[model samples]
Target: MKILICLSNVPDTTTKAKFVNDNTAFDTTGVQWIINPWDELALTRAIELKTDAANTIENITVITVGGKDAEPTMRKALAIGADDAVRIDVEPKDAYFVAAQIAEYLKSNPFDLIFSGIESADYNGSAVGGMVAEFLNAPSVSAVSGLNIEGGQVKITRDIDGGQEEVSVEMPAVLTVQKGIAKEPMIAAMRGIMMARKKPLNVVAPVEVEALTEIVNFEMPQPKPACKMIEPENVKELVDLLQNEAKVI
Candidate 1:
């Protein structure tokens, strides 16, 4: 089985986000980038799955849509245990463009299983995995929290309204993994890091796809208001606040 995992390089969660180009583009100045947390989970889980299957999986290839600036993150994914990497040479415009680039890359090189995060941390669009499945005309499972492979079939558990649902499907399917699908991401060991330098990092030109959306502006949310304390005996006041001031009631 050949497995393909989609990854993204994103600003660390601790980084202070800023926008440039009249607030229409993210500013990368002085920002530290890392493999997106959700994508890391997907990669780690794919590694675990491959290992546990007694070498049923032949290779685990990680792919991304970005320029050379994103190569560091790709190497990090390789260090985490992917067999190889593919970097589509292009500026990642949006979720649609990214997914289209990946789908286009997969046209000639298909895999038995495809893994991606439900959404990227920076955009939180939650759209790419499903869009890639649509572009490839393949069955897709989203928000997957549990995965198991038996024989040639794949079973997945996902979150649903008020509960969870389990589904099984054949090979050549796409999955959008969620956080709990795997344990905390493993730190890349020194040996793995060294081995990653020798691993293949193939670069390919992106296939043509017109962008469907554009960012008009970016704005940070307003600072939250300070909390107000109410005395225990002021029940009526608390009720009034809930009914009028907070308006939650």
Candidate 2:
């Protein structure tokens, strides 16, 4: 069984976000890029699944919709254990266009299981995975926390309303995973990093797909208010402040 993991290149979580071009574009200066955290966990689980000699997993491939700048993240994924990587040669404009490009690729090259993170760290859109599944007319499971292939059966444990639900879906399905998919993302070893240079990173041109939405502007949230300190003797004052200024009570 061949597995395809959809990767997203995002600014590291620790990087300070900055906007430019009159708040119309993200500032890329001195930013470190990495694979989306959730996607990294998905890739880790994919590698773990392939480790079992019984699963008969053929190969693992990572795919992304991005231009040349995204190759570094893809290479990091290869170092994590993907057999190869594919990048659609285009800047991802929006969720729909990105999903369409992936779906277009899937039409020509099929895989038994397709894994996508529930959302991208930068945008947190949470829309691409379901959109890709819709484009392919395939079933999809979202918010998956547990996944395993046992005796050729695909088992998924996902979060539901107030509880968890276990499901088994057919092949050629998409799974959008959240946290807990794996204990933690696998770090690439020195040997794996050297081997990643030899792994194939395929670049394909994107098909024509108009983005459904446009970014008008990006507005940052207002800065948080300073916390006021209170002493043990100021309990009444604190209560007064909470009731009047804070307005919680």
Candidate 3:
């Protein structure tokens, strides 16, 4: 079995987001790029499944849709433990474009299992996984919290309203994994880093696909109001503030 995991390069969570070009594009200056947190967990789970003693997986490849500037993030993914990497050379304009590009690649190279995070940290538009599945005409499971192979069958566990549901899926299926898929992300060890230096990172040209959406402008959220503190003795004032200002009471 082979696994393909999708990765998205995103700004570090601590970085203050800013936009430029008249607030039409993101400002990448002085920003630290990291793998999407959810995607990292999916990659971690893929590595764990591969390293198991009774593993049946043969290769684990990570793919991303980005420009040359995104290679560093892809390298980090390889260092953490993917067997190889594939880059679809294009700026990921939106969920639709990205899903289309990756699906185009899968036309020639197929994998038994494909893992996509529930959403990208930057966009949080949980749509790519299902789009890929639709494009490939393959079965998919969403909100997947658990995934494993038993008796050569793919089993998936998902959280429901009152309980969890488990089901077995056939191969060549897509799974959109959420938080509980892995405990922690796999850190790149020194030896893994050295080995990653030799791992192939193949770059593929993206096919022509008209972008379905366009960003008109970027807007920053309004600043939060300052906190007001009142003495514990001022019970009446606190109640008045809650009722009038905070609107809680």
Highest lDDT model number: 2
Write the residue-wise lDDT of candidate 3 on 4-93 in tens digits: 999999999898989999999889999999999988999999999888757688999999999998899889999999999999998888
lDDT of 2 by residue, 4-82 (tens): 9999999999998889999999999999999999999999999999999798899999999998999999999999899
Could you tell me every candidate's TM-score relative to the true structure? 0.93, 0.96, 0.94
* Model 3 CA deviation exceeding 4 Å by range: 232-249
Candidate 1 vs 2: which has more lDDT: 2
Ranking by TM-score: 2, 3, 1
Best by TM-score: 2
Q: Name the regions of candidate 2 deviating beyond 4 angstroms.
A: 232-240, 243-245
Please estimate how well model 2 matches the true structure, expressed as its whole-model Cα lDDT. Answer: 0.95
Candidate 1 lDDT over residue span 67-99, tens digit each = 999999999999989999999999988899999
* Steric clash count of candidate 3: 0
TM-score of 1: 0.93
Model 1 misplacement above 4 A? 53-55, 230-240
Error of 1 at 8 (Å): 0.9
Q: Judge candidate 3 at residue 144 and give its lDDT.
A: 87
lDDT of each: 0.90, 0.95, 0.91
